[model samples]
Target chain A: MTTSKQSAPISFERERPAGKSAARYILGRRLSRVWLYTLLIVTGLAFGLPFFWTISSSLKSITEIYIFPPTMWPAEIRWKNYADVFTIAPFARFIWNTVIVTLLAMLGQILSAAVVAFGFTRFRFPGRESLFVLVLSTIMLPWQVTIVPQFLLFRYLGWINTYWPLIIPSYFGGGAFYIFLLRQFFLTIPKDLDEAAKLDGASNFRIFWNIVLPLSKAALATVAIFSFIGHWNEFFAPLIYLNSTDKFTISIGLRYFVSNPFESDEPREAILMAASLITALPVLILFFVAQKYFVQGIVTTGLKG
Target chain B: MAAATGRSWWHSSAQRREALEGYLWISPWVIGFLLFALGPMIASLYLSFTEYKIGGSPVWLGLENYIRAFSQDKLFWPSLNRTAYFAIATVGLGTVGSLLAAILLNQNARGRNFFRALYYLPSLTPVVALAILWQWLLQPQVGFVNYALYQMGIDGPGWLTSRQWAVPSLILISLWAGIGGGRMIIFLAGLQGVPQELYESAELDGASTLQRFFNITLPMISPVILFNVILGVIGSFSVFALAYVATDGGPNYATYFFVLHLYYNAFSYFQMGYASALAWVFFLIIFILSFVQIKFSDRWVYYEFS
Candidate 1:
């Protein structure tokens, strides 16, 4: 919202007078700016401290981890803890499994969403508007309503404890919000470009693949990144569908570590933090890398529920 | 564009051909709707009325599941109340806190983008990781929170372990992870849309800063506020992962939310019929609540130019 780096708060945006009181007004504005910066920096630190603590805790050794006054930073940074995370559990396989599911689901979401969005954007047919409205209304329905029967259906198909249940649904248009998002983006592409492609007798699929899709890289990337983060961070579906330890994602693997019974009084906090950090790193990196897409996707859709 | 009366079934007229192509393009969504949503939803409704357990056929037991939920089950009503408590506290506090953070961020100060991204970092963390991290962080004698308290010459309460503190502890953890998240971003968008001229004119009229905010900003953003609240209610009501991981609804079921109860019934005990009944009731409550909210929002939330 701020247009310039030097701009003060809205309360201090009034015109400066040339009289003797002008000095007082400038002083007031400077004080307000000082107040704003201090508040922002303090809140930023409050938000930033947890991740810093987690990362710092991840590096601590087990003996130093349970010390009374928790160390802000470990005296000796344990690179071995990262290695030990794999020893206690199959964390590397978990990471690989997460990557496979996220990537496949993202690909399915992008392609299917793009096709469905193009259908809504370019085609005119009976009941087209109402059908699109039906798609949008489904956004309000919570997933818990359909989850039980879906679980039963997948069980009937002998799909439990496999990756099929987690990834197959993405091949069917991702969800309503992504379709709405891509459709909104598709409406912005000029119809005349496709009209020209039509003059050459290009098939509808060709016009979609060759002409429109190239111009839609940004929107497609938005869909890709959003779905990637969503699928990667998803805990509920993977927890229910993939029950075997060998098929565990990072989420269930971490859960397995902490929830498993132990003879010792204290569980391994250091290793848990390390595993937790590893589990959360990919999405955090994605957030930083594709920050703008996150913002644009949220704002453009205007409905996240 | 084709005349309906003259069209034949096998004839490939222009409008008929285009309509067929359209249906073909949208077939993925159509198939998904049948396979996942509509079909499963109907099955779930039917299952709710029967006495089906895992690996057993559904038997006719009309209204028994619903009656048990209302009259016989003891944990059902308490869990629902606990869930209501959690939802109300989260939505009410979350809306106010995020809105204030948004107002603060809307300033013309420097390093705005960096601050925005920093605050949003928590929202990006996976739920499993967040729950574990907080569990370790609040580990009474060894946690950072109690260590700070001990240094202040005070003994910290048993956070996740104590019944009195469990739900409040969850609300605290959730707010920490969610305060500067999507609701903040959405509020920022709403703040940006408020016309600058209104504020300027109000300032010129010698209105105080709070007066200007109340008169112009609140009314302009009321619709956005309503939107955020509704989404917040839905999100907060179905909170399962955090409680499931952090406390596992322990310490005498202090944090046993509704969905957690439903999950235990369906999966843990194979009470599929009862769980389905619980799900239907859950859906109806949310539906009626949302419908009532939209119907009543016009009393406060007015559009600038609808």
Candidate 2:
């Protein structure tokens, strides 16, 4: 919605600030524009420079990395650092683990959230509003409150050191936030469609499957993109559950990379940067590719709340 | 909209079936809620009052762990104080920064989207990646941040290394990565919702820009601001991975916040009872903070519908 969001700044040609006042208004606007750019450029660089450093440093030669007043551009791009990242540890396996958890969790979260949201939006029953309130309340409930018992529960189930702990809970309900998001989206879909489908003797599940799910693709994609970034970046749970190195996700794998049995020597900072870049690359690509969905997710939740 | 049946009362078998179907459709979430959320919460509450370090049944400790947290644990009060300080700095600066950035980005122009994307880039980076990257960037001797400071004849502090700057450094990292993301977008949405006509009217009334901002923009978006601050406080309070990685609550425990204390107690020291008590305290603080904010927000928060 922020795309070309505002109409041309309330063009009130009538009774506008006149004469020197108009010029002063224009001059004030110009002065503020100058200030805006000054702040924007400074902060833009503040945000962008670290990313630039990380990206450039990832490709830098080890010597270039240590150079005083680090070079903005690498003198020689060393693709070797990227390759060396794989040899140093089970980096590929870590990526594979992260991908598996993210994919499975996304699938679970999307399907279950869609189902729950449909139930909440399409069907009305006794205490429905109260039940929905309960669902919404969980959004404010911090994961920390439930994390210990959850860890103990998982450990007791012998699900520790496996992907089960990471992926299983997602199937039950994606989360309260996603449920709320999709519920909002679902409420906007005309109930006449469901009624039309039902008039044809369609089952509730049939209408949900054939009519609602297809129409909700955009909302679902928003959830999916958020899911990908969230799961990819998730560090806390994986840190607790997957203690074995061979089973580690990229987040923790990189954490303990220095002591990898595969590499006796400490890896170069460039190589580590390269590894970090690799870990962060997929989400970045997804962001640029699906920037609309990601930003829409933010705007939707922000304004709707 | 009650249902397709359009019946609030289940007088007919069809209405009954609709009710059953609704329940059936929502059953999975209900099960999950019970198993994961409600069950665990109740268990943790019970565990907080009992000592259980796994491998043995919980010995009923009544209020010992709670008492210990208040009076015994050396790090508990200090860590909480540290966390409160961290929350104030990060949330305060972050909300203001995001609001300012949103105001700036709201202008209609070319390259606005580019700048918005630039601003959002850090938030997309994984928290672990951010921690490590900042660690490298703030390296006392070789860091580029210090190098820049040197150009200005200002000696940059040790940052994550110095006890004095550890919390500040963590706050800086959090702000750098977070200030431009969702909260900014929220503020942008809020700003967009403030009718352009209001500004046009204010302009005709001869209100200065500062006057318009104070009287119009601020009041219009106060609800969003309140929501962001509440979320920001909750987020900053429980933040773990950044500190866990950047400093490990370190450089002499200056960056050790409340959650890390709970984490170490439960996971590292196996003080499950104590950790649960800490967690309950954390939950209650968040609950009360949210409650108080909502209760008092009526004084300042303007709701359009109401």
Candidate 3:
């Protein structure tokens, strides 16, 4: 992907020396190129600067953060801040809990959304259009609107403190967005293969499991990555559902250092930064690994479509 | 005889069998939608009319919570007003900025792909990490942003701390963190769809680049622009984590986005019924706004497929 764009012939090279006003054209083009490059650099910095600041602040001592003209780079890197983070909060437990939820959610979403998307895309389905629209409607409603009822339902089931509330929904068709995303990829598959499978007496489920699943690797990887990141960073659901401190995900646990009003300890900046970095690490790594798929999914699918 | 045959109400045939297979294939999602998604939505709607606190049975009170929110509650309107103000400002600036960035990055130039990935890195950064980082950067007294402003002989206002600036500060942060995906992706899609012939034709007519962009690219991409606008508004309205992490709704009651307000009401105040009403109202508002946008977009947006 990178090489194609990088190695592609520059669009400018073909546009040399026209019959009329060549000097004026070259001057105008030069001015435009300068302006475009200037715009690109400024915006690049705007987007990139926050990440630079995050890593810098994560390395700084708490006292140094509060110092005037905040050091762009710490004079001395304090790697012990990673140690401080765990001491200040239940960081390990949070990581374990987050890992479990993320894995479960990712697996569940892959199975359910893919199966459903296959049905919508591959099969001749009755009420397919209407049901697909119904599924799409779920994306339209914000999670905030459903919090109360979900809380009540979970409470009734005695699953509030358990990971069931977080993981089980994914098993039962997690996100409409993933379903729609997978559906797009599924549609691009040739229908002739399904017909051949039918001739071989392969059932729909068998075809879906054996053939469709293997072929849709990019889409599946994209779904897995997205679902993992979504579950990893989810704060509100965990905040509401998990009652026990030990059950809290990394996102909820990270709140203990700086924001928890109930804990009267002074805000530990170093620890908080460390915890934030730790919480973000898995997602960052996952994104880099499957970035091509992620980019493809976004370009093809609607925003949460 | 076959032509005159009357079909039974329940037809047992290959076509009917295929239909059944289709239903079977899709049953998992249907069951899930009914049980998990639709069930809760309906429950919330029902609960909005009934005063149901935790550990207490719901008492039927028709429109009581809605009435209280409108007539009695002081924070409700101001909080909503604040949220609306925040949404408009953030979506307005962020969409334009991100779209421009997408366009600039879309140009075939040196290091374009690297710049594309660079800009998207912030979006990939975990929301918690970015929020905490912004909290430090926006810290009034000794933060980098203010310190730099100080060096320039410009005194920066108390950002998250001041009621007047709290929402605006959040708007800026939201834009910074929120830029990578929606506008950029939509613009990428729009850019791909723009006809090369149009640009060639425009150049032949001695039209300048700016004129070509305005005349060709803008109109061609208007559908995508409208789509992003609708999604952006819906997203901006429901924003919670960034505001919750950064300000806890403020030094005063400033950055209390509607979702945060709903969260406090339901969780802290234990006003489940009231919160449910607020949630419904938000859904209604978003639906109406998006509906209006789509209605207006019909005239301007060019859908080539149509």
Please report the candidate that would top lDDT against the real structure. 2
Under CAPRI classification, how is model 3 graded? Answer: acceptable
RMSD of 1: 5.2
- Given candidate 2, what's the lDDT at residue A69? 76
C-alpha positional error of residue B240 in candidate 1 after TM-score superposition, expressed in Å: 0.4
**Residue A293 lDDT, candidate 1, scale 0-100:** 78
lDDT of 1 by residue, B133-168 (tens): 998878888988888789999999999999999999
Per residue, candidate 3 scores C-alpha lDDT tens digits across B1-306 of 132332541265765676677677667788888777788788888889989898998889999989988889888898888888888987888788777777776655578767877777777666667788778778889776788799999999988888878877888888887777647766765665465667766678998857766777788777767768888898889888888888888777777778888999999988888889988888788889987987887788766655
TM-scores of all candidate predictions against the true structure: 0.92, 0.93, 0.91
Q: How big is the positional error of residue B165 in model 1, measured in Å on the Cα after superposition?
A: 0.6
TM-score (C-alpha) between model 2 and the true structure = 0.93
DockQ for each of the predicted structures, in order? 0.39, 0.40, 0.38
Rate residue B280 of model 1 by lDDT.
Answer: 91
In candidate 2, list every pair of residues with a backbone clash. none
Model 1 lDDT at residue B85: 95
Q: What lDDT does the true structure give each of the candidates?
A: 0.82, 0.83, 0.76
